[model samples]
Target: MSNIKKIVDIGDKELEVWKSGKGRTIIILPGMMSSLAEWELLYEELSKEARVIIYYRAGYGKSDKGKIPRNCTENAKDLYALMKKLRITSPIIIGHSYGGLILQEFVMKYPNEASEIILVDSTSYGAHKLDEVEIEEEDGSSTEAWVEKCKIYSSLSKEVLQVEMAEWITEMKKNLSSSQHLEVEEFMSNPVMFESLSEELEHDLLTCGETNQHKSFPNTSTIVIGRDPKASITEMVESEGLHRSEAEEIELIWQTLILNQTKLNYKTTYIMAEGSGHSVHLEKPEVIKKAVDSILNSTEVED
Candidate 1:
């Protein structure tokens, strides 16, 4: 497969997009604080069967940082516009983490434009509610504390930033292979990554609020894959200061929320990645590939 990279002007700003393979289009949407390179493994695998479009969101990679107040609505609109400009029709949409929320808004607004939707370990509507768990920090308010931390992160020297990012990539390598981790590390080395992430976090609450309003999503073929909540129960309890029992209860609540996601559509399938964490696509690419293939094959049968 050959990679075709291009910059498309989206009125306000330009987005860097990469396309490869041929056939049905499958657009991969990256999560918060991530670039298209984060999907390198899955993109390589999926592109073999279908045309894949991966783009850096505004403020990441070579993409221009557009205006602020960039909540889910704005994100969804930008993606829809890009698809229209590219003349992509009824494409399969795959969203990871926060990208899933944007996908939700997209399907709701342009129901006819999407053939299927796959949400990989996506965030729940209740994600904005953090008061249930006590997050460890010097300040009581986690949001305010996080904002202050971002300021510190933004001010770090390039060498210190690289070191910090390397450490993070090393931790992520536990879930991803060495090469995959290296690719992600290289993409994240861009200073703009942190800045974009901070800007996204600034509108987290607003984004979730907008998502909450769209409880009834379009009735389309949808797949919801959630990482096993058991994988993080202990970490949540120990690090987040939640009681052991509380952590277990929270896990159950999370699973319930994930299951509830299927209610958004008429034909929806839910899967749990047995040993995977939130980054199921990276940790268990086979699971994701199988899901995508299943959707594609099913779509073919219907056609």
Candidate 2:
């Protein structure tokens, strides 16, 4: 089926949005340093059964670069504006990685906007606090390992940045075409993408803390997706210089954080998407569809 793509103006920022399928509204938000291209396959698959919407946030893809000091609060404000501009309401929202953090802020700020929530191996609400506290990797590495990596990415030249990024999301983008790959490449090529990514990460602690400060989230139907540790443990040890034990510790924290989110929701379901790392939606599209179908079916039954 044909997917409609164009620029959408949400006040000062103009976002690039894609629309496909023709059933209930399904809104998918990508992670930090990510774009619509990375999850095209999943979008297409989901489009076959439901209306699908994915967009490039400011500074990514064709979207305009928003002001600096960008954090979850600002991002949530933008998302609300975009939803209003699109006249969307009660959409089933799915977030992956940083997108999940954004989802938390959004539901907290605008409780009636979304009918359902799905987090695909998403960032924990308070994981950013690790940047403040001590998190020793195997060799007693600095707690800023991940933050340092983002700083490096922001400093690299465009060509180097693209290559560095291409090395990642490789398995998840296996279905991506050369053209689609170009879209991803173009996204990485933008200096603003790196800048925006770094800023968001820098403000992550604030975002998490602010989300915590907000009153408890409204009673919403939510789903939390976690990854099978095997998919990422080896990478953490080999690529990230983490000891196996350290990696296991981090994984334990992540799993615990995910499970705890369910307690915050009035109705919730937690599922582990296997055979993939953090980008579970890309590696296991069927599982995402399964989640959507289950929720849709339950809603139908409730009605």
Candidate 3:
């Protein structure tokens, strides 16, 4: 019931693809550090009613890692090229996390390509600004004082702390949109690439956060935000300098940003997945599916 193949000339690398169904076209984009495998459930469900195309991004899954740019805009351009290569027109896009951000870029950058967007736990900022974070050292001195900082880079990133609560760990892992994999493993192994990617991602993500005002979609869109527990929220508020009101404010700003830029008289829906984190798809796929289906049904094409 499923067909799998590889396309070698899409982006800077090959895209491993799984395609099914035969009706309206839908492209499923998974989160960073995740591949098409993460969309198995949603793919299966959507395939029953629509043609679904699922593929891994460059540097993910069976996709090759070439010398292309790694920023979200580049990723979105690659996606557009792939779809054009495959001759798909006006597809419905299901994007999660970084994939969601890529979809946003695609919709804004190529307004004619997609009919709608489903944003799953996307990050947004009213302004493209980054917080200045302090790096702590074990010696209680500034990171500048550490002479061999590069030596400990690999150790710090790869080190996974042992969890005392199995249930909580299981739940946490379930809710993650992405996780470490072979490519991530390789990046973590190479200190230079690791640090380089981190710094690049820092600037890229800040740009994405700030450029939210310029991004828009032409059709219908929906956003799902996974709510962490009150305890977790409290901790984030205290440690990250974000109050509960700030979170609410950010959500409101995010909605307004997308709604204003949308060109197709866009209808927007917002869903809050309670007791979950950013990884609502993995932690609560059913909830996401229900929300997605609701949007698709509401915007069903007339006969």
Point to the candidate with the largest TM-score.
Answer: 2
Model 2: lowest-lDDT 10 consecutive positions: 134-143
| Residue 180 accuracy (lDDT) in model 3 | 27
What's each prediction's TM-score?
Answer: 0.86, 0.87, 0.66
lDDT (C-alpha) at residue 44 in model 2: 88
Best by lDDT: 2
Residue 300's lDDT within candidate 2 is: 85
Q: What is the lDDT of residue 18 in candidate 2?
A: 97
**How displaced is residue 42 in candidate 3, in Å?**
2.8
Could you tell me how far off, in angstroms, the CA of residue 63 lies in candidate 3 after the best superposition?
1.9
Off by over 4 Å in 2: 129-175, 210-212, 238-241
> Candidate 3's residue-wise lDDT over 175-196, tens digit each?
3245423333333334333333
lDDT of 3 at 277: 56
Better of 2 and 3 by TM-score: 2
Alpha-carbon lDDT of model 1: 0.77
Off by over 4 Å in 1: 135-144, 155-160, 172-186, 210-215, 234-243
Clashes counted in candidate 1 amount to 0
Q: Give the per-residue lDDT digits (tens) of candidate 1, residues 137-232.
A: 524445555556666676776567778778666665565556566556655566666666665666664346444475457788899998888776
